[model samples]
Target: MSKYDLIIRNGNIVTAETIIQGDIAIKDGKIAETSAGQSLKAIAKSEINADGLHIFPGLIDTHVHFNEPGRTEWEGLETGSRSLAGGGVTTFIDMPLNSTPPAINKKNLALKKAAAEKNSLVHARFWGGLVPENINDLKDLFEDGVLGFKAFMSPSGITDFNHVDDVTIFKGMNEIARLGSLLAVHAESTVICDQLAQEKIAEGKTSARDFVESRPIISEIEAVRRIISYAEATGCKLHIVHASSRKVVEVINEAKLRGVDVTVETCPHYLSLTIKDLEQKGGVAKCCPPLREENEVEGLWNAVANGEIDVIASDHSPAPPHMKEIQDGDYFKAWGGISGAQSTLNVMLTEGYVKRALPLEKIVQLTATNPAKLFGLFPNKGTISVGSDADLAIVNLNESFELKREDLFYRHQHSPYVGKTFNGKIITTLINGELVFKNGDFKKRAQETV
Candidate 1:
């Protein structure tokens, strides 16, 4: 009988710090050993020859809205995890919004967990919502094992999950700090965005360009500034999510230098697409704190290369075809989200590593390692080292493919990257030593409990 359950050999294993050509032995869902250029004596139930490919630690997406329970039509845990698996993601944390009741308290958390338990194909975690009305729910939700809390300074677009004010932010942050939990914010000033949006709508300008103009860079930066101050004052570990502006990056970097406990994340859309894509693609490319010009995109990329931006998540929020307003072509009326969980790792591999010459190690840090550390899943889910969970993404960097609607696994099956080609492709994904995805097919397993 084989001592090991499975062994993956001859692949270049990418870790947070280095790459090693090795064979990994897995037993009972954890990596038992990784031998570099040497064969292990233990036989295995299965062996995979992974020559000429890269074995990366499965990605951890810290931001996604798999609107479940209440709004599964927009995106459900089942399809969401399928999309994430296609992107080489092994674990994800769903946001509180977009879901029907929003995960604000014990009841809502239970509801979302029930939905996820029935349908999720990958390991799942959650972020509790922080709104003006839910200030008291922080400690209870944190104790309930939510990874963190997500608050919005600007309008969250859902009536149930309202944007928080300064007072509520202070109260919630104090509670979160006391409990040793992190708070991630959608840092955009509601006043600035609301005023600009109304002014543009009054001008009868509802084009995509006008939408970008409505959420000016100042709106985002100002909210970041306020949140940072509140975090510092309340002694909360703060995280700025979907940071799109270079100015926001600069501010966060300065704050970090000053010893503020903060980190920031950018999305693939900001790094790969720009305002031009918005103008051309219309509602599909529209997002809050809208995509900036080419220079800003380049600056954000530089920040990623420099280690200033800590994480890269898809912020994968999806809506129905009609919600995108694809037919009306009105950015103001469209839902402000991008269905991109499946394209995060591919885009980063193409633009960050292949074209920009960023090291594979850095990509691993941005896409997997840092997020794992930030969200309290490190050492287990984000590294390929010994004793880690045997979750991996095997990719062929030499291959490339154009993203089409048929390639999408999300419920809506639409994305702005529909026609764009990416350099790397995820050939297989292993979750907990199970071959869940391979060669564009998903082998659905029973839902995993946390």
Candidate 2:
């Protein structure tokens, strides 16, 4: 009889700390043993030759907008999770906006769970919505297994999910602290953005550049300061999502030094793309806390390299093409999002490693390890250690390919990264010791349970 279920041999194993040449033994979907530069003596039912490939932990994207149930036309759980698996992601936490009847209360959480049970291809969790009206709903959702609570300090771009004020923020923070759950905020002050946007519109300035200029760095920095103060006063663990500005990073670092229980995440778009790129791509590249200048992009990269930023996520918000009409090219009128879940790892590898020379271990940390720890899915989901889930990605570091919209698997074909050439390619992705993607094809497996 075979002693192991699967064996991956002759690969360079990369983790947050070091890289080693090893052979991994997996039994019943868990890592059984890992021997450096030597194959296991026990028999195996199946073996994969990973010669010349880099094996890293499957990515955990803690922040993604998988618009489903009520908003399937925008993007559904099926397509969203498929794209994630194709990019080497094994776990994802869905945000509570974009979908109608967002996951704010217990009723909404149940509805979202039912939808995910049918379409989710990998392990999934959800975030409860935090708004003024939903203050009473947080505890129930937390008890119901929501990973955290998500609040927007500014208008969330959707009317049903309203923005929160300072008063509501304090209340929500206290509630989340009581539940021992983290609060993730979209950290731009609506008061500041609304004022600037109104002034620009009055002046007949609605171009992409004008939109970027309207929401300045100060708006983000001011909101971070406010949230940090509240987090300190209430003893709430806070996570600022999609942090864009260098000034905001400085504030977060200072708060951490001052003993605040806080962390921050930056999206791949902010790290790889810039205001100049946004200007050239127009509405397709638009996002909230819009892309910053080239110098600011450099500062964000430095933060990622130095570990000032805690996690890197896709913020994979997607919308239909009708909403992002490039012909109109009016930034204020276009939908605010970017579709890059399937391209995050490759884009980061191309931009962070090839161009900037950031170490591969750091990329593993930002994309996989940190996110798993933050979302309470650690040990099992983020590392390649013994007793962990056998979820891994085999990467071809020397390969190169140009990103094309038609080649993507997302429900919407539009992408901000179209025509960009990337250096790394994911050759095979394994979930629970089973091949899910390989050789440009997706292998269907049994639906995963939450």
Q: Count clashing residue pairs per candidate.
A: 1, 0
TM-score for each model: 0.98, 0.98
Model 1 spans with C-alpha error above 4 angstroms: 326-329
lDDT of 2: 0.89
The TM-score of predicted model 1 comes to 0.98
> What is the C-alpha lDDT profile of model 1 across 1-450, one tens digit per residue?
888999999899999899988899999899999998776777899999899999999999999999998898998999999999998999999999989899999889999988888898888899999988887888889888899999988788899999888888899999999999999999888898899889998988888788888898888889999988887798899999999977899999999988999999999999999999988887778888788999999999889888889999999989988888755556888888988999999999999899999999999999899989988788998999888999999999999999999999999988999999999999999998999999889998655676
All candidates: CA RMSD (Å):
1.0, 1.1
Worst lDDT 10-window in candidate 2: 324-333
What lDDT is reached at residue 170 by model 2? 99
Error of 2 at 96 (Å): 0.9
Candidate 2 accuracy as TM-score:
0.98
- Please report, in order, the local distance difference test score of every candidate based on alpha carbons: 0.90, 0.89
